[model samples]
Target chain A: MALELLKERWSSAINVLKVGAVKEEGGTRASAITVGGQTTLPFLLDEGGMPHRPVVAMEIFDVAPLEWPVSLLEPFGDAVKDPVKWAKKCINEFKADLICLTLKGTHPEAENISADKAVELVKNMLKEISTPLIIIGSGDKEKDNDVLARCSQATKGENCLFGLAAQDNFKTLVASCMADDHCIIADSPIDINIAKQVNILITDMGFKPEKIAMHPSTAALGYGMEYVYSIMERSRLAAFVGDKMLAMPFIIFVGQEAWKVKEAAANVADEPGWGDERMRGPLWEAATAVAMLHAGADILVMRHPEAVATVKRSIDSMMKGNND
Target chain B: MLVIGELINGMYQNVEQAIKTKNRSIIHKLAKEQLEAGADMLDINAGPHGADPKETMRWLIETIREVTPAPLAIDSTKLDVVELGLKLAGEGSMINSTKADDEKLDIYVPLAKKYKAKLIGLTMDKKGVPRDKNVKCELAAKILAKCMEMDLPLEDVYIDPIVLPVNVAQAQCAELLDVLREFKLISDPPPQTVVGLSNVSQGTKQRSLINRTYLVMAVASGLSGAIVDPLDKELMDAMITAELLLNKNIYCDSYIDAYRKR
Candidate 1:
């Protein structure tokens, strides 16, 4: 008897979306990042094609972080005091594929930075680095609607990927992206149906389906990571099985979720048996990111340079197909 | 659930008059309304009154295609009329039905294969509707066997156990539901099950209530598709809720609105 192999072919594929634009395309970035365009499960090369490998976007905040632990902040040094230097280090030394700048200062509870100030910071960051950018607003819904819209206009031709478009507050951001020719990140809390509904709502507002990426929400490695993993797996399965509305590529904030968890944030004295705080912290973030890649994350927004390097190696190995 | 819109048939006075007078507006309006109401596919039928049923089907298909690219179900009992519709309907369309009889299967199965359309096999023959669940299952088994022999994919084959009106044949309604459950066990990849949902409420006073209840019951029994009036908002709501309960769709406060938009 001969050995038999079973392979399932899918009827549809994830829409391929390109983020950023170069000088010739009316953008200041050196190159655009392409994601999605997979017709099968992640790294199942024998069954179907995964044309673009998953990329990493290192996170930097517009305002200096007041809460980041010393272990996590040690690598960046004085760059942590300035957003432009932090973004430049992420692109030049950390070798990040893209820069994810969060406008935390614009939140009402924070510095309450004006939209004009946020736009000036974005312009300075763009001038400092040629890497594609992923700009997200502060968590406040009302504040984000105002700040993100202004940032979106300032970077009109840059074609940056904007973020956190929720079901209720997507209209302003969607209109901005439509006018400025940029991609969007749709946010959904761990529910597959809500993820789909958010995408539908954005598309209904005339946003092209191909240009939208999904953030199905994320969790730390030991803190309900399985929930985020399962939701993403189910979502990818739905896409492969021809659900057009659920077929956008996934964007996960591995660093934001992982670093907040105590396992990654606790000091060595707090838990002696868990190994060194510095090693455990970055490893925890890296592990969460790698796990997300297996669950079909097209782009991972991570913190910590060490964790980013570790995840980049994993992505390289996974992109080598089944030969290894 | 696959909601096949059943409003385009010439059996309806408006549709019949439109077909006789070649009024594209009425047919076009029905087609658009059914689709907007969340019909996965439209069922096209030329009733007995049309002198040239083939011509009527062509016109109906052409009129619908001009408006939307949604898939059509070429529905008719006549083989020639169905063949004509299939030829003009393009791909992703379905043959409304063929019987469980071998002679009908021998012709209709190949016709379906040739046209690359799905086949709906009714689990009844010259003996008419089966009297019990066991007999219906046997007929369904026969249809599955024929589909396998003809190399027609079972996934594309829909087995209808035939619904009986509640006002007349009340006892058979339960029997029909049982037959739908049994149909799943007939093959490794079971054939999809569908029913003309309106049949269960024929001549009943609370037609809408009976039809909605029976449709939900049928869905619980693994009925994958149905031919119903999509324009009935309450009926569509009940069907959507049934699917949500089955965990086919995730629950949200505006799940009904989300489903409609999808």
Candidate 2:
């Protein structure tokens, strides 16, 4: 039997975004980070060029988490309460590429912190860390609109990545990002159509496409990971075939979703086979991140320092000989 | 889809008047309106109303140039008028057409190379408008062969399988779509395909309805561009919705506006 070689050709490519603008480019940071611009599937080094490596962003909170699993809480120790110190630990100790400062305290059901308080906390975090910031607000639509707008104003020209501009509550956040010249995260609930629609709506307002990232909601391994997997795959495929709306770099909320799954951190006192919850949680998070990387995730928001390290090691290894 | 707006052609009453009087305002207004209505390029034909089409084409090019930098389609059967339009319209101008036959291609095909302009090649030959898919496909292949021999890039070449009037050539309508689908197989990197879209609806009472429905069918068959009226709102909407359904454009709730923006 004779084997004939046939190569697949792609008409379009995903757009690369240089997210955090440094001082020379009008932002205060010393460095900028670029993501996306993959012509082929992720880590398929032989297929095409992956111009930028996938970077890890460790999620920090404006207020301390009261319900974090014991496995997650043990690492931060006392630094969890203060946002600045928490951001510093992600950068200084854990070597996170970016810090995603989520204002979880501003949720109406939670602490219900005012916009000013959230802004103030952000200002403090900015003063403390030089790693690029991805500022996200509480999931509550009304509260996020009020809080994120103020936060955007405080970080004007800093070129921070602000996000979760969902379908129902995008206007205020989009306006804030536009006015401040910051990047936006277009979020959808694991649906490609919704993801594409949100992107189009934002771009229709004259928002630059490169100043956007996609957040197709993620689920952890052994917990509907297939849904997240396929959505991301379809999104990247569409982008490769020249769908501009879905071409932005993907930002998977790895830490939040992966940790939330029972397989990652569930206390297994009843089942002897579920052994060693400590190692299991972070390992689950890492495995989930690795699979997502293969499925075209461009940014990973992760917790569990060990999990972050494991993901980082894998990225470094995969990215080592990527020249085609 | 590449929309070459048809409104600027002097066959229209307003354009005819603009050509005769050399009234830059009337011509510029038409050019600006068509551009705003989402035309990628404007077809500047001085029509039968012009005493000297070459002078009229030059006038239109000069007037439109003052307002916008959108590319112009140098539309004329006369080589001199087409050449003058190209001269004034500059680098990105498109030759509105040439037939597959040697008599037309000998002149117009080289003009595309000389000026580095995009060329549109018609499927009809000396025998006249193609009667069926076989003739259309055969003519397209002949044009592709000519383009190759002349060292012309197929990427810049557009194959136009002429759209006949539905009221007359009803039997040929379905076959035209088949020709459009088969055009890609003529070359590895297929030449782009466009059609004179309104011709499909000529003499029909439901002109807009037939034109749009046929345009969508053409689009589904891999037609890449068309010379049509951008100002036709329903027609433009149908084209955009078809593109979205065909996955040519990304989906958005406000996709119509977004498609225009893109």
Tell me the alpha-carbon RMSD of every candidate. 2.5, 3.4
Candidate 1 chain A, poorest ten consecutive residues by summed lDDT: A315-324
Candidate 1 positional error at B82, Å: 1.7
> What is candidate 2's lDDT per residue for A1-324, written digit by digit as tens?
899766555777888887777788877776888999888888877677799999999998888886888988899999998888888988999999999989898999998999989988888877778878999988898888888899999989888999889888799999999999999999998888888889888887878999999998988898888898998888788778767777899999889988898777776684458877789899999999999999899889999999999999999989985422
What TM-score does each of the candidates earn? Answer: 0.92, 0.88
lDDT leader: 1
Alpha-carbon runs more than 4 Å astray in model 1: A2-5, A23-26, A167-172, A193-197, A200-206, A242-245, A265-278
Model 1, span A210-275: residue lDDT tens: 999999999889888899999988887867765667889999999989999888989989898888
Score residue B141 of candidate 1 by CA lDDT: 88
**For model 2, what is the C-alpha lDDT against the true structure?**
0.87
Candidate 1 chain B: 10-residue stretch with minimal lDDT: B249-258
Q: What is the lDDT of residue A291 in candidate 1?
A: 91
Model 1 per-residue lDDT at A157: 94
What is the DockQ (computed on Cα atoms) for candidate 1?
0.28
lDDT of 1 by residue, B145-235 (tens): 8888989888888888888899889998988888888888888777799999998898989999999999999999999999999999999
Q: Write the per-residue lDDT of candidate 2 for residues B29-120, one digit (tens) a residue.
A: 88888888878899988898667788788778888999999999988988899888888888978998899998788788788999989999
